[model samples]
Target chain A: MAKRAAFDIPDGAYVNLGIGIPELVAKYVPEGREVVYHTENGLLGMGPSPADGEGDPELINAGKRQITAVPGASYFHHADSFVMIRGGHIDICVLGAMQVSETGDLANWSTGSPDAIPAVGGAMDLVAGANAIRVVTQHCTRDGQPKLVEACSYPLTGAGVVKRVYTDLAVVDISGDGFQLVELAPGIDFEHVRDLTAAELRPLPN
Target chain B: MIDKELPTAAEAVADVFDGATVMIGGFGEAGSPIELIHALIDQGASGLTVVNNNAGSGEVGLAALLKSGRVSKLICSYPRTAGSRVFPDLYRSGRIELELVPQGTLSERIRAGGAGIPAFFTPTAVGTPLQDGKETRTFDGRDYVMEHGLTADFALVKCSRADRHGNLVYNKTARNFGPVMATAATTTIVQASEIVDIGVLDPEAVVTPGIFVSRVVGVAEPALESELVARGVSYP
Candidate 1:
């Protein structure tokens, strides 16, 4: 049971997506469910992308790229958007990851560099506000080092923020015990995934 | 002279016209423009379309405006959720508008607006729901689409330090939207936690040079409450 499926979309939930990888969730959001898309930029009720020459320059999502407004959509001060997030209105925040600790701490911002570009952005607010947080990323670095670590080496973006881990190679759940093997990627088995992971792997129930 | 009395962010904004678009700069919670927002509340400015990155939580930034039922439209990335007390109420009542954009594109639009470019070209929005309804053209076998620059009648910003002449110096994390927005607004108003001497500020450290700022005001930590807390400060 590989947890990383390209088509597993959440339903009718308001989601705040972090940059880079999480934005892909919009493309796979489930049908027949009223999943209201939110951007930290102060927009709600946003729809899927529109056809060329049909897009309004003024309309866009939190990522700051142009997007279409949903039929019932509305707007507010940029600060108000954070109110919604920090105030606990968001259900899930799908974030990309630099590293994930066994205790679910997210260290996505700095590599100890003063010049890191992303700067944790809205992640701090999302971590505090969102009831559930999911991470989408590759399991390892370019040099074949595992990103799922025993303890994050970088400054943390959010403490204990992650609930589920969906990587290209495996799906690991974070708990007090450790990285529980919830599922494995297709063409790979538990043994192979465990060998590549930095943290201890917990076997899923048969 | 130090003044203790003031209005609120919602009260000030209620007086603004129904369709007024405002530009607010801040990356996230770090650099949110809140002072002018407080004044807008006192003025009762309303029916506004605000542009910025992410709104603030209840007591700290744009969240106060959302709670007050003032802003009618938003051009930003983050949206209010079900648990967000006031924002959800507003959303449920059908009184708000939300827009989401790519973070890079949002910054670029403000920067483009500041630079006087009518619109810029980028491939950032090609495939996602972000690309719908935009114009696209090709250059050298590469496709580039147009995303319009952003501007506003009023710009509200917070500075770590400011001079009497209106130059601004912001610390790290807080520089997100201030500098570019300084150029996009017709009359930019700035609030500094500490107003500094004219010559004391190093010219190199000034993110927004004085020419871009129109008004300078100083506030203590409490004035920040309205910008931060949706319940707002007591005086307003």
Candidate 2:
């Protein structure tokens, strides 16, 4: 799934990777494209995570995990980093999701459950400001419920902001027709993918 | 030459009185002025309005401060986290109030306050519940939300180093909101890892100019939660 997600990033694109699985996209930036990584905690040219015993305590990502910095790296205050995000400078943002709507609404920040912690760190800003947003998540919940829904029951991070959904099972694009099937995972058929998705699926012609 | 050095964290934050609006700089526990916060906790000032990125985490820092029942209100972005029990407990019981701002909006508001701008428009929370009561306007045919600049009576920040004049530099990501928070307050007190001579630091290396800082106290031992956690020390 990380390799599949890495294939979509264009060259020289400035990108922000959300915590969790999206962080893996940084490791698989296709070797040639100089994808500039941005962390909401105030780094511009971020490199990959450090190997064991090589980590720097102060130099970390938004996830609060230690990471390395690429050459030509520069730092700014938290405010300026958001300016890069909210001012429409970020080309792409890959985020994890609790649920994604057929209409491209993203509900990743919170589940709206009473006990859930509502930590909305830069999710709304990234969704509203980034040129494009892609969500990475499993096709089904741990309970086996579909995550691609007709409408998100959870509180939305942004309305109609998601451009694509990269699940472990399939790659779906939110379009005018809603939940267009872009590609399926290995050994998975259209019927199997459709059964796993709660939203309506429209397959594109060959 | 003007010297703004203070003897101790307690002395540095001694003037942060009750009911004061204080801006505590940090993203989680990174740039948090832990010593100053502990001093403030010892100072026992109640009904304080605190502004920060997160309410608190683990059981120390701002969380410990909030746990003391000193905070009456929290004006921040991400107010709740898994390990943040102080805020949730206080919030659920209605003992404390919250004005949850978007992270970007919070940063901009602080930056705008420091820049002397009254208010600005942002597209961040236009269609969400956060924008419900805010004044909205349109520019170039696109909708934007109005957010007022935020300032505080005192700002407590953490820095990697400081000069006698209070010029500051920060460690990597730990610099998060420290620079902006220092500027947005009437009295900015900094906790420095090392206090150097006036000519030791290059003018080009200074992130927060001395003009914005009112006090600087060198921590005998400068420790961050990330480092502490890495060392297997209990963070809270």
Candidate 3:
């Protein structure tokens, strides 16, 4: 799913990858593509993790993990860092999703459980401000429930904000009409993907 | 003489009273001022309203401050993180109150507070549970929720370098909430790894000007929160 999402990123795009599977997109951005990674905690041109025992306690990513700065990296404060996000300067944002509605609403932040500690972080801002939003996740939950549904059961992070979704079983786009199947994963039939989706799965255009 | 330097961390935070609103700068532990936090803990002020991006990771820094039960309310973006049990436990037990804001909104609120803006409208959190009970207005046919500016009585931040006048330079991504929080607070206290003489730091490279800062304390060998958590060290 990460590789498939990476394929869609245009060269030289300034991208923000949400923590979890989305973070893996950085490693698969096809060779020769010069993408600048943005970590919302205040660094652009974010580099990979430093060598073992060489990490600086102060230089880390939004996930609070030690990271290195690329040669041309630039640092700013939180306000400026968020301006790049909320000002529509960021080109792409790949995020993990808990549920996606047929109309492109994203619900990745909270489960809304009575006892759960609700933490939204930057998910809302990314969805609201990024030029394009992509989600990468499993097609279904561990309990065999569909994550793609007619309406999100969980609380939404943003409304009608997602553009496309890359799942382990297939690639889908959130069209004006609804879920449009773009491609099926190898060995997985369209019927199989459709069976797992709780919403209408429009077949690829001929 | 524009000397903002203070002799010790404890002294820097000595005047913090109970029920004060304080903002501690950090995104996790990267920009966390452990020494100042430790001092705040020792100073024994209670009923603080604290703000930060995340609840502290382990039993150190912000977590230690939370564990001390000094903070009664927390205004932050995310509080649940790996190795973070302090805030969640307190929250679940109905001990600590939390006002969860979106990260960008939180940053903007602080910035607005510093810039003297009372309130602003943003598209973030619209059509979500977070937007519930908030005022909404339509602009260009798009709805935006209103968020009030946030200010604090004190701000605790960590920086890489500082001058006698309190101009600061931070280390990489650790510069997170420091600059903005410094502006939004009445008395911004900073812990610097190195305090240089006046006119030594380049004027152009300073990230935070002295006007926002009230006191600067030198913590040449600041303790790493990750190391402390790794060692299972708990604060006194």
Candidate 4:
């Protein structure tokens, strides 16, 4: 999933990776190319995670995990980091989503669960601010429930912000005619994709 | 010799009355003013509305402050972390109130408050639940929600170094909300790890100028739970 998402990131682009699965994209960023990672906690030019026992308690990412900074890295206030995001200074923001509608709406912060605590974090700001966005998630829930749907039943993080979705089963793009399948996983066919998706899927062009 | 340094942390925050809005700087445990927070707890001020990045973590610092039941409301972005259980328990049990703001919005609001800007618009939370009932307008085509500038009666910050004039510098990512929060409050109190001479700190290296800071208290041993653990001190 990280390798697939990395292909979409252009060199010298300022990118913000959301927590969870989306953060894996940083490890897969093509070697020798500059992809500046912005953490909403206020560090830019973020480097890879530190090795065990070498972690600095003070050096952390927005996800509250220990990380390292690359050469010439800079830090700023949390507000300025968002200004970089909301002002469209960030080129790409890869995030994890709980649900993606056929029309490209995103719902990732909350599942509308009554007993669960809702933590918005920086998802809202990143979604609304990025010039382009890509969502990475599992195709279905543990119980075989599809995440991609006709419309999000859960609360939305943003409206019409997701452009591409990288799931376990396939890579799809939000299109006028619903989810258009771009590439299928090896050995998986259209029938398998259709069976797992709750939303209508448009077949790949011949 | 203008000495802005106070003798004690308690003395630095002595004037903080009840029902005052205070901005506490920190992102997780990095730059948390744990010593100052302990002083606030000891001073026994109540009904405070705290503006911060995270609510608090574990059973010390901000978490301990929240657990004291003295804080009436929390104005923060991310209130939940791995070790954060105090605010959740208090909030669920009707002991505390929360005003959840996006991390960026929270930063900008405090910054604007200090910079004399009343309010501004952005597209961060236009269609989400956070934007509900907020004044929004169309600018150049897209929708933007109006967020007001946030200021506090006092700001408690943690710094790595400070001169007698109150000019401060921070350590690494620990700088988090310190710079912005310093300007957004009426009385900005700092807990510095080391107090240097005025000219010792280069002007170009200062992240927050002395003009915004009202008081600086020198702390020989800044109390940080993470640092304690890193030094092999078992927390109580």
Best by lDDT: 3
RMSD of 4: 1.9
RMSD of each: 17.8, 2.1, 0.9, 1.9
| Winner on DockQ (2 vs 4) | 4
In angstroms, how far off is B35's CA in candidate 1? Answer: 3.4
| Share of the reference A-B contacts seen in candidate 3 | 0.91
Query: DockQ of candidates 1 onward, in order?
Result: 0.03, 0.66, 0.91, 0.74
Which CAPRI category fits model 4?
medium
Winner on lDDT (1 vs 3):
3
**Which parts of model 1 have CA positions greater than 4 angstroms off?**
A1-206, B1-18, B80-83, B222-236
Candidate 4 on B46-160: residue-level lDDT in tens? 9999988787766778888898889999998878777567888988887888898988888889999999999999898888889999999998999999999999999999999
Ranking by DockQ: 3, 4, 2, 1
Q: Residue A129 in candidate 4 has what lDDT?
A: 89
Q: lDDT per residue, candidate 3, A1-206, as tens digits? A: 99999999989999999998999999999998999999999999999999998989788888878899999999999999999999999999999999999999999988999989989999999999999999999999999999999999999999999999999999999999899999999999989999999999998879
What TM-score does the A-chain of candidate 3 achieve? 0.99
Instruction: Give per-residue CA lDDT, model 2, range A33-128, as digits (tens).
Output: 888999999999999889999986678888877888899888889989999999999999999999999999888877767665457888999998
Native contacts retained by model 4, as a fraction? Answer: 0.68
On the 0 to 100 scale, the lDDT of residue A102 in model 4 is 94
Estimate candidate 4's alpha-carbon lDDT, on a 0 to 1 scale: 0.88
lDDT for model 2, please: 0.88
lDDT of 3 by residue, B1-236 (tens): 78899999999999999999999998888889999999999999999999999889788889999999999999999998887789889999999999999999999999999999999999999999999999999999999999999999999999999998999999988899999999999999999999999988999999999999999999999998888999999987
Pairs of colliding residues, candidate 4 = none
**What TM-scores result for chain A when each predicted structure is judged separately against the true chain A?**
0.90, 0.96, 0.99, 0.96
